[model samples]
Target: MSLAEHVSQRAEKKESSMTQQTQDTTTADLAAGFAAGLDPREVAEAVLSRIAEREPVLNAFYLHDPDQVRADAAASAARWAAGTQRSKYDGVPVTVKENIPRAGHPVPSGTALANPPIAQSNAPVTDRLLEAGMVILGSTTMPDWGMLSSGVSSLHGISRNAWNPALTTGGSSAGAGAAAAAGYGPLHVGTDIGGSIRLPGTWAGLATLKPSAGLVPLHAPYLGRAAGPLSRTVAGAADLMSVIARPDARDYSTRPYPQMDWTKILSSPRGLRVGLQLHAGPGAAVDPEVAAAVQSAAEMFSAAGATVVSVAPFLTQEVLTGIDAFWRTRSWADYKALDEEARGSLLPYIARWCTGGKDYDGAATIQNYQRFGQLQQATREATEGFDLVLSPVAPMAAFGAEDPMPSNDPDTPMTHISFTLPYNMSGQPAATINCGFTSDGRTIGLQVAGRVGADDDVLAACAWYESVRGDAAPDWSRVP
Candidate 1:
């Protein structure tokens, strides 16, 4: 055969592999459905129907246009029919968080502080997803400046738990979490600086990953900030990760990394060194139920022949307080830039929290900066000897939908993030998988964190845990 024929044959075989599957909206599923001649318009309509059913109570989106969704699906269907589908994910619907820009869409930044401008271009990750032929559903909602760890947003209104509408879906990826749990579609892209993605992953009973800082490209990369995937299953999250992590020249920070074989992201936990952390050094005490769930999951590893050891709390109040101080300074700068009316539109809770930036002198600000470094060093030291650490994703289950955070105190908003924050600064890859549930049916998350740049292993460990967790995983497809 000619070279061109060989390449075409390869593509055909690859496409054929995705032909037999279900209609769950997972990338694999959608790809299979498409290969079987399933109309992309039908998939779009089903997802829209789901959104209509869930949106009124969940408030899980900032921009959800059925017209736009239909348009994108039509384009994907055309590509598939022409045998020029962008990638294996063609026709799969996915939602982008409001803060992550898609060309021509306004990034609201999760606050009512001002009318955010329409982005003139796409964030690198967004471009990659579009290139892969994933249909964009719309932008999801988040809390003010993504500062709070709950669903109450000043601009987008409050997003609620998918499991129970009265409860909050953890923020700033609030809408993504709710959408995933409600099965609005297969993929939900979110960004996390502290615990935004995983907190919501836990609260909403989803699988999510916070890749190493530079592993997934971001437009304006900053310390600890990363773009990642949130989905109902690890396989779904992995499908999105493989695409978003593709090299992009715009984000120079995403460089010099070996190509990953995502198929290898499922391994046995046997013979692996594991550390168990029930208490985050200083923050909200893990509720008894939450702690028990984590502990039980850890014991499963022990039973599976993995060495499990308890690690001492490594965080300090000084570091937590200082990091908050630095963030206060950053947000305050943004607040000061706004005109009087725009500033007045800011969320009062966040305003009360970060306004103290004015009080910090140069020396104090430097001191706060030092605290962030201390946190980075301390987190590294705490998880140094272990291959992976198992911990509770949150102190408790979802809180009231209207509360700004789990603590309900702006002064101490970082309280629930202790378990998941350290990995962000250390640039370690961490994942959240449902290990158990609260007494009332809310899900509890088991955090699997690997060393810095160990994204694949972190995912593998999460997959291993999920396999062993058995029926504990929620039937999101069938769940209400």
Candidate 2:
């Protein structure tokens, strides 16, 4: 089937689930009611109503069970009513990436071939969220195996950006970013191997954190790594991260990290070392408006006592080339193992790229790993004195819904790694916060990256930045 045909089929499959009604409660309002003893079922119903209203156009979700969500919400509400709400996320509606498993949900791994039977258990991350009293709204969509930056999937239709429906929502966390931005859910859990979470967050004007590697457990099978939570505010992101940052026995990659008192740490952003990179390597070019927005944010940091300075040794082509090789090789191996018919049904762009493994050889793969090690050494050497690095989250503001990124031009060779890919390669905690809007009215994000295992530091920097510049609330009036 063609990509469009597959999308049509997926849309038809969801039509039934999308028919449910939604409620008119904002996160703040829901929290207020919970504090005042309102029934949790009512809150869940409100969230459902909003999802029904928004899902058709945004296509943010892949699976939803209003009945199940309502039941979970009711249970949570009862706990709160009995003065037993266990965690900070009590009764909040949140969505997880489809790649992550929830009990009884199929683990598609965002691919048609891997549509295995329903998962028998929850991923460790999901368990943590449930422990924190969060109610699962549903699973959001991603590209097949999350190999693409644009959130276009053969199994699921394109996820449109909330800002401009015509523009692409940066992916593979496209649906999570759009859903959270549109308020389908105030919180969304997504993973970032490349720029999945950060790119979408930039496109949707939402706050996203790609925590340092190993800070959060990687319990999802097939993929050895993933992260979660695309939220409307830095605080919301921090809240979700805190709950999921614990060590999980099932995932050996998870390790114990410093216990975070996020609320206390994020109360202020004073005394931070904020280094700003104006240019991202040789030949890196950014839209004038985006550049201005980033500069404006640097100035805000300076006003807030952050030492913002122009710096170099940002990201070298050698580092990004190595990371690209790693992604391609891993993806090619996974794709080749798919059933013949299932492979045939994949989107052409994905099939073509994944199957084209001419550039990767055994020696090349080993060298790539070694190159990454050298890149990490370089990063550590240059970033030792700074607490955080600030840059434009993307080279440009959100693009047309049909096109999430720029054309694959050689001059803009580093566009894909503009501000996000480096952190993933370095395994450092990085986040994006809404700084301001362009004259054309699209949102611009300020990227903040901290030392490895400094997830709390990244959040604190975002909190401080937000406090100084004020919230970048969605201008509903500008919605197309």
Candidate 3:
């Protein structure tokens, strides 16, 4: 398929059943409810109530205006009553990641910057969601400079896991994960440059699709960054995609594609070639429990008639380190742009991580940037013959909520991302589904990645898995 082409597409249970969970109202349900005369105010009230009850526990949103949410929802309810709702899913409450610009909202990027610049306009995805009438509950928080895979944010504090407050929410997309698990709303939009979306999605036991890079226009599009949806259901994420995955002149990265039926993409995986990747190659060894959970998930796919082949790691330690160098250099430049106060107030770990690159010459930056293409080539070569690939989302289990990363070593903080970083570089569509839970009660995410630009195909296969996975919706509350 071409970059602008359209294609069609088509989990297991976890231990320690999460009981006493808040009810999740999917975007589809919210739309149906509105169509059937349900008031948007009801959704606003319920969501606000949930946030009011859990925000202190999770620290999900960096800027949530309940009054504005209620008022917009009331306006949506008025539209529904007048038979003029903006779109099918109008009035569905959703949250934007702190990094994604929302008009009048600060784009902190999870830094403790004393005064971050306010965005003058909405990002492409945010604009699309607003045009479709989705109510913006607020911006979800993330770790400093959006550089960590854990939720120890310097600005909004820690975004605790809903499954266990002591555990990390595995981020860059941290608060979105917490809010989704806490049932704040059905739809959320987050960015994924290196597992930011899928890691958090998996840790929070949510369904997330990191679509082909450039498929969704970003306000500040980068090499591997893609704005994606994190929702309680694959359908909900797809629904959000239907709106956000549109052309935007602001994003030179965007390709021209016709609007997709989104629903038609959820097809079966009965005759697909699936590569089963056990290890992420260069990072921490895959946790035994996580591997087992993924193994079982692969078996489920095999039973569904996919040709599940075992695949070897394509990433090397050199490439991993090189990529980390690129990130550090990039972050260091940003770090240098800020005032001394902002720089000093950054999370200590992040500050140190960026400082490591302060002396990097242009040669070092170019060499590190070249590793992106090297890894991309390796990933493309590894999965060339497969229609999709299944793997663990991260190498290790959930770590402490306050730790900057699972390794907790600023000098070497990217091992867990080895599994997820590849897809971002390759520009492939990868989704994370709840396969099972770890012994410590953390959720295990089974990653499903399809050919680049074949988002519909992979999502369809995921939809198929969701249908047969026999598990109830992920246990969102504590397992008592």
Candidate 4:
């Protein structure tokens, strides 16, 4: 046969397979329905309808194009009808973090310094989602350069928590967490260097994964940055993992090991060793309700036949502060590079963060990294005998949406997120699952972290917890 004929035949075969498949817009349900011959357009319409109702109040999306959604859905529908569906998540509505590029959308990195320019191509994770047949919903919001732990961004404005409009959505994955909690759809993407994913997951009452560095590839790689899914269900997040964790040539940090079936690992975590560590170190105070929720989840693990024990904090306050110092030093350099006008336009909190490391030299920066390594080594050694460590996802609950951090006190912000950042420095997988809520009804999260390359195990424990705990959340729009 001619080369052209062979190519054409392959294309026809692909189209033939497109001829195939949810409540709360779960990607799994949508994909299953599409495979069973359901029209993708209906799913698209439902998602769009939900967005129309929720966007004004939630501010979860920075860029949502209904026309694009419709067009993609139509194509997916045709493919399914033709039995040419690409992957399991095909036609499922998925949102990406704005910092991660999407074709034709501007990624301003949630900063005034970002001069908007349409991207020529998608980020690696974005490409993976598209390849699997997932419909692109829109890009979600973040804090400026993902600086703050709260959702207050100077560029896109505040992204309010879905549970309570008056409360802040923990960030810099603010929009992803809020959207997941709000039932915007079943799958959303979030990035974490510090506690961006888990903090929002904790505050918004959703499940988020900060997969071990390189477990999920990025378009541009960095030391402490990793990205993963934010979902209402652990299974939904696992589904996203199966797609987005595909290896990318751009990231060399990804493990050389074969990919594991995350969905299969969601079995009960019986016989696993779990540790409860309330704080990263002393002097970091955790709210009573938050501590109680984490303790409650540990008890649940014990009930499931796992050996649960309390371990002294492996990280010191200096080590905890070192992680933030590492970030600030980089930000300080970036601040120095910015022209006068751009510097003037930066958000006040971010400006403060940038200047926080101004007095430190490169030698000080290197010392911070050295301290970071020591902490990572110590943490791994301490948890070596355990399968997972259980802790409060945040030291505090969601506060007012307008506040820069938990309070006006500059020192308190890091304390609010102390438990989650050490793992980031360690380059280990960590996740936050809703364990309970505070007295005022704000959500609390129980964090689960595993050794590097144990992303599957960490997620499995969370999924198991979700099964017993039940993935119940208040519908934000329905409230009041």
Candidate 5:
């Protein structure tokens, strides 16, 4: 039978009582439900129903197949009912980014110009998640080529923040953030090159971890390496990371790290040195409320017996210039290859910058890479004594949906990098936690970054902060 027909058959067999029970349970609660003999298929059906009802307005999902999800869920249910649930993520529904390949799923990577056929095999990370028993609901939206920071995309359209759909949800993992924040799914897999994962988490009031470069594999169909989770809590993010963190033969860049037991290690946050820095460069423009929220989080850490110190050596213009040059130079080939129609379809700012191709020369590219290396070294030196660094996740909360990012300033401009990209360049592990809310009711995030191999420390710090300041649960009532 066709995929749609398969889904219809399963939907027909779904019991009303089972639907009610699954609909009422949280993602964590659903895991508990499976533990209690509840059917995984029922849970998956309820999740698909929730997404069907909510996605039309949210625009979070780019591709979905209810039949495939039902089949996977039924298999998971059988495993759970037989006392053989394979992994920690058993029965959980997750949204995968378009850039990550899932066998038989169309992964256009958000480019309207190119419609690559459905993938023939799963990306290594996707395989890991499936092996761990998670059900894939659909692909989430992201920027064309994953180049821009704003969540607007020509291929899948804009993914607005869940708190207020009128505002931007941040990108390139835009739709993943919206889905998690809107409760379309409890877990979302996203990529980060610039502020992709953390920025969206900040705007949508979700938790996210941009694992240290190489912690998660990035393979075919994904040009750059990035795979992380967007979720309602830090522990949930950690759990997803643990499942996808193993080294894969497909990705030569995958780092060798001990497999983490998240439940055991992240049970409580203790013995961590936290450093707070609001300014990263000479002209870092930090929104007053955002800075205040970050400071308040630091104070909470102090009260929780963690050392909080103000550190300088913030992100400098030189550092940003170098990073920008690196991206332009590295992605130059890809931009040039795009046909005019595809080029025309991109967000204007992205099209302008990406297509420019004249800013940095070969020598400049190498120099920028060298300069970035120095900055990474400097960051490591400055943060040597600390276990984690705390700061605002973004310069401000979600901007208006119509005007996603400022477009005028280009050279050494003081824009939204106050909280994000530095960590990306540094290749350090970073996470965003819901620190508080703006007066306008939009969410604000506090960023915690750890050293190269300190992914667990970052997760633990977020967990500590969450314990003191409770998690900001998504407002389902506002979900469209």
Candidate 6:
């Protein structure tokens, strides 16, 4: 039988469990409630209360305006009452990563830069969410400059994992994942250049998509940064994607595609080709449990009639060289732009990274771009036959909350993010779906990536995995 058929049978056997625990304001659950005459104000209040009760532990929000949120919720409630709801997201609460601009909000991007100017306009992603009527709950946290994969942000302190406060919540979309895991609300916007979205999503037991670069237009100064959703359910991510991926003239990088119903893409997984990629490169070492979880995900896909094959590492030296030379160095140039006083205010490690970017001269920058082109082409050739690629989101599990990166890595601080950065270099679509948990209860994410402009296919593959892999949802009762 097909995967959809199996899901139907499973659904029949397992009666829908909308327990009180499951009522933690997921996108789908909130939408259904709003459609059924639920009061948007009440939903907003519950979310605010949860944030207030949990903020001390999670540190999920950098800034949240409760009064503004209530006003928006009141407007949304009025719209639903008049039978004029904007969309399925009309009353659903959502969080935006701190780096992404929202009108009248502070865009700290997790830094101690003194009294930064407030945003006077909405980012395209934020505009789209507001247009679709998603109630903005607040802004989530991220590492300073979004450079690290761990949750140590000097500006916001450290964001603790919802699963375990002692462990780090992987970043730079740190608070988005923590908020989702902590049951703050359903839909959240997260930016991923490297593994920001996927790493945090997995570590916090949430579903996330690093949509194709140019899939969701972003305001980042460099390439490879894309804004996408983090949610507890694949359906929620799909719904948010449909809204935010809409074309915007402001974002020159956005690749325009005809509006498609992304939700319908998950119907079947038969006759699909899936490649299982374990190691990112020679030096990258994956945790045994993470590899096992990904392996199990591959087996589930194969059982669902998809052709699953183990693939060799395709991230070549050229690709690695390009990403390191162009992306990271160029990113540090922004910090390099800051005055010495502002730079001194930055976290010491962030200042170190910025200082390192000074070594790349003009000739090297141009050469890196050329190498970037070659790497993109090579990545295209590498996975030509596969509809999707399956891999581990991070090489290791969540480490200490205060640590910048993993503890054992002596040579490079970026090893944990190795698996997820190649897609950024190639500008392809990738996602992290929670596959299982570690013995210590850290969530494990299995990545699904597809060719550039094949975001729907990637989302479909994730939806398929979630369907077949029963128990994809986190236990909200355990949330902080």
TM-score for all models, in order of appearance: 0.93, 0.88, 0.93, 0.91, 0.89, 0.91
User: Per-residue alpha-carbon lDDT of model 5 for 316-349, expressed as tens digits?
Assistant: 7776777677766666667777777766766666
lDDT of 6: 0.78
Predicted candidate 6 versus true structure: per-residue lDDT over 64-90, tens digit per residue: 889989999999999999999999679
Query: How many clashes does the backbone of model 3 have?
Result: 11
Report residue 413 deviation for candidate 6 (angstroms). Answer: 2.4
| Per-residue alpha-carbon lDDT of candidate 3 for residues 1-480, written as tens digits (9 for 90 to 100) | 110111010012111111111244566666766776666776677678778878888898999999999999999999988989999878888999988998887897887777788999989988998899989999999898789988888887889988889989889999998888788888888899899999997788889999998899999989999999898788878888888888899999998655556787544567889999998778898889989988988998898788999999999999999989888988888888877877789988988998888777999889989999999999999999999899999877778898888887888888888889999999999998888887667788889998877887777777777777765247653521
TM-score of 3: 0.93
| Candidate 3 wrongly placed segments (more than 4 Å) | 1-22, 265-267, 471-473, 477-480
Lowest summed lDDT across 10 adjacent residues in model 1 is found at 14-23
RMSD of each: 5.4, 7.7, 6.7, 7.0, 5.0, 5.2
Per-residue lDDT for 162 in model 2? 76
Of candidates 5 and 1, the better by lDDT: 1
Number of clashing residue pairs in every model?
0, 15, 11, 20, 3, 0
Score each candidate by Cα lDDT. Answer: 0.83, 0.73, 0.83, 0.79, 0.74, 0.78
lDDT (10s digit) by residue, model 4, range 363-386 = 888888787788778877878888
Task: Tell me the tens digit of each residue's lDDT in model 2 across 380-467.
Answer: 6667788989888778777766542455432233455547766776788889988878887778888888998888878877877777
Report the Cα lDDT for residue 187, model 3.
84
Lowest lDDT sum, 10 consecutive residues, model 5, at 1-10
Ranking by TM-score: 1, 3, 4, 6, 5, 2
